[model samples]
Target chain A: MEEEAKAKPRNPSGPRLCCVCNTRRAALKRPKTLDQICRECFYEVFEEEIHQVIVENQLFSPGERIAIGASGGKGEHGLLSINLYFCSVEDSTVLAYVLSTLNRRHHYGLDLFLLSVDEGITGYRDDSLETVKRNEIQYGLPLKVVSYKDLYGWTMDEIVKMIGLKNNCTFCGVFRRQALDRGAAMLKVDKVATGHNADDIAETVLLNILRGDIARLGRCTAITTGEDGPIPRCKPFKHLFSKCISRFCSGVHQGFGKNKVVSSLTIRNCGLQKPRAILDIIKSGEDFRISTSTKMPEQGTCERCGYISSQAIDRATKVIIPGWKWCKACVLLEGLNKGLPKMGIGRSRGLNNDRKDAKGNDNAAKSIESKQCGTLDF
Target chain B: MQLTLEFGGGLELLCDSVKIHKVSVEPQNGAEMLTMKDLLTWVRTNLIKERPEMFMKGDTVRPGVLVLVNDCDWELSGQLNTTLEDKDVVVFISTLHGG
Candidate 1:
C-alpha cells in the first residue's frame, strides 16, 4: 500500500530503509528509541504500545462503555485555563481513531463514545467541537456534549465578562472537573479515557511539586484516577509522548507558553534533549511517599451533587445549605451565581460575609440557587 | 528556487492563518545552492506575521516543531543543512500544542 511513496525519487539525504522491516523508506525518527522507522511500522508500534498499556494496567474489562474526554485540556499545568486549545483537535481525533481501532482489533469489547465539555469559549471551543463532531461520524462513535450554560446557567464567556480574566481559569478548571463527570454519567459510561500523554503527566508532576501540592503530586502519575467517583478516568497515552500522538494524527500546533506559574515549554525542552526525562519524572513522582502525619484531604461525596469531593463543607456554606457539602464546582458556581465570584477560589476564605448576606438580606433567589450548580440537572 | 511550504497544527496561526505558501527564494551571499537554513531565514522574515519566537529558536525551528521535506521527516533529510530543490515541498508542524 505504501509502494507508491517508495517509488518517489529519493531526496538529497537519500532513503533510509526502515530499521525494523529493512523495507519501506523510514518516515520518522522516534523520540523514545531514536529509531528511524517507516510509516507502517511506526503506526503498528504506536498502537501496540498503547494496547499493551491498556492490557497491563487493566484499564478496561469486556463490554464496558468508555467515554473519551475529547478535550485537549487533560493533564495540563499552571495555566490550565486555556488548555482546551492545547492540541484540542488532533489529540482527541487520534484518540478516537486509535481507541476504536484497538477496540475492534483486540476485541476489547468496549463501547467507546466521545464526550466533550463545551466551556462556551466562543471561537476556541466552537472550532474544536466541530472537529469532534466530524470524528463522531468518521469513527462511527456516538458523541455527547455537555455545556457550561446548561449545567451552571453561565458560559465561560459570561464568566469572563463578570469576573474578568484575573481568575477565570480557576473558574474554568473547576467547572470542567464536574462537567466531564456529568457528561460521562449522561452517556452511562463505566470509565472515561483522556488523551493525556507522558509529557502532560510529567509537566503536571513538575507543576505540582513546584506548588507544593503533595496530594496531586502523588496521584498525578497514576494511569487511572477517581476510582471511587461515579466515573473513573484513565490515560491510555500516559506512556506515550505528545509528539508521537500528534504526529500519528498527522499535524501539530504550537502550544505557546501561557502558564505564568511555570513554563511547560522548558519541560518540553528537557524532553526534546532527553526523552527519557519524561518517564523519569513520572517515576520520581510515583515513588514519592507522603508521611502518615501529613493531612491529605479526605475524599467524600458532595452533598449537593453527590460527586466525590475532597473538600468538607465550611461552617458558613453549611449554614446556608444546612449540612449539605458542596464540591469545588458547586462552590465556584455558587460564587458566580451569588455574584461573590471568589467563594471557593484559591485559599479557603471565611464566608462570614456570605452568611451575613444570606441572613440580613434573606435573598431567597441567591441563597437558594444551589439548583443551578448540581450534576443532577442533567 | 521555488518551494511549497505548508503549516498545520497551529503554525498557520503564526503566518496570518494561511496554511500554504508558494514562494521563491534565492541563496544569500550568491551561494550556489539554497539550504533549509536560508529558507528558514526567508520564512521568518517574510511569512511569519506574529510571535516569531514561537516559530523559531536559534538558527532552526523551535524544538517541538516537526519539519518534513518532500513528505519525509526532516531528520531523514539533513534538517537545516538539507539543500532545497526546485518545487520541493517543505512542511513545518508545531507538535507543542495540546496533549
Candidate 2:
C-alpha cells in the first residue's frame, strides 16, 4: 500500500511470449495492473487440457466441490477467483472451486491468505483472525486454514530444529504433500489440484533420477493422480512449464501493478541445486530416447501409511502403516547421509528402457482402467 | 591382465580396491582361462562376505566398475562363458547417472 513498495524494478524486463503457447504475451512481463490476459490464456489452455483428462477419466463428478490448495502464492492464491472468473464465461458447472485449508507454517498470517487454523500459536491464529475479519468483507469465497503443528507433527521451525535447515525443506515438501491429501479428505472434496507446473515436474523428474530415485521418477508426470492415497490429486499445470508459469505471474503483476495484495513468499532453497548436475541425463534421454541403465527396484508399501514406500521390502508384510504417506522424497529425507540408494527409494523408474519396471503399485490400476479416458492417458 | 572395472553412483561402497576381486587362470599346456560368471562368483565369495556393504544385491553395474575380460560388461554375456585371452583387460568403472 506504500509508494516505495510499489516501485517497479529499474530497467525491469519487458513482457515475453507465454511459455505455454509462445505466441501470446507471457504473464511475467506485466505491471502491477490487470492486463493478465496472456496469463489467463495460458491458464485457460492448461485447464482445458486438464479438463480433458478429467472428462476422459471422469476424475471428477458434476456439482462436486473440489478444493484447490491455496498457498496465497501465485500457484494457489486467488485460484478460485481466477478460475471462477473464467468459468463464469464458459458456464461449466462440472466443477466448483472451494478454498481449502491453508498450511499455516510458522509465518501463519504473515503469508498472503485469510484462513487461519486453531494451532494455539498466538500470533499465527490472531493474524489469521485479522485476515478473516479483513477478507470476509471483500472476498466471498469460503476459506479453511490448516495449521503447521497439526498436519505435520511439527512446524517448519520445529522441523528445522529437529533436522537441520537443509533437511527441513524436505519436511515441508513431504508434509505439504501428505497434508494436502489429508486436508482434501477433511474438506470432503472429490479431488484436490495443486499449481505444480511442468518445470516443477520436469525439474523433479531430473532430480529424482540424478539421485537415482527410482520410485518418484515413475509418479511425477501424472496430471490427475498420485500413489495410493485417499484422495486423487490433479496438477492443472502438469504440461505448463516454468517459463510459461512465470510469464503468467508477471503479466498479472503488471496488470495489477498497484493491487493491494502481493506475493509475500520467503522460502527459497527448494532443493533445486541437486538437478543442476543432471542436465545431460535429461538432454540425452530427449536427444536419444535413451536412459542410463538402473537396477530393478523393489516396491513395497510403507508400514506406516500404506503409500508406496520402497523400504517395506516384503510386499505381504502387514504393518500398522502410519497415518502419513510420504513420497520417496520424504522417505529419502530421513537420513541425508545415506547417499543415492536411500534417497533413490520411491523415485521414478527410468533412465533406460521404455517400460519402467514398476517400483510402485499398479494393482488397482484396473479399477480405474475401465474408466480410463482414452484421449487423456497420462 | 589390466581389466578395468566400473560401478555407478554407489559403486564406491563396493570393494575398496577395484581389482581386489580379479582372478587368474592357466590354460592348456600351461595356458590360463577365466569367465564373467567366475568373476561375479568371485566377487560374491571374497568381497561380499568380508565387506557386505560394498555391493547391493541386484543393481545394474556401471562402466566405472567395469569387469572387462577384453573390455566390456561381462554381465552382458559370456559370464563364466567368456574365455579369458592373453593380456585380457577386465576393467571396472564407476559411472555417473546424470541427465
Model 1 C-alpha RMSD vs. true structure (Å) is: 8.1
Best by TM-score: 1
Each candidate: what lDDT?
A: 0.73, 0.36
TM-score per prediction, in order, is: 0.86, 0.39
Worst 10 residues of 1 chain A by lDDT: A369-378
Off by over 4 Å in 1: A1-14, A72-87, A251-263, A310-324, A349-378
Give the backbone clash total of model 2. 84
lDDT of 1 by residue, B1-99 (tens): 888898877788888888889999999999999999999999999999977877888998887787888767877777888887777888887766532
TM-score of chain B of each: 0.96, 0.45
Q: Give the share of true interchain contacts found in each model.
A: 0.38, 0.00
lDDT of prediction 1 = 0.73
Spell out the clash pairs found in candidate 1: A86-B98, A87-B98, A253-B9
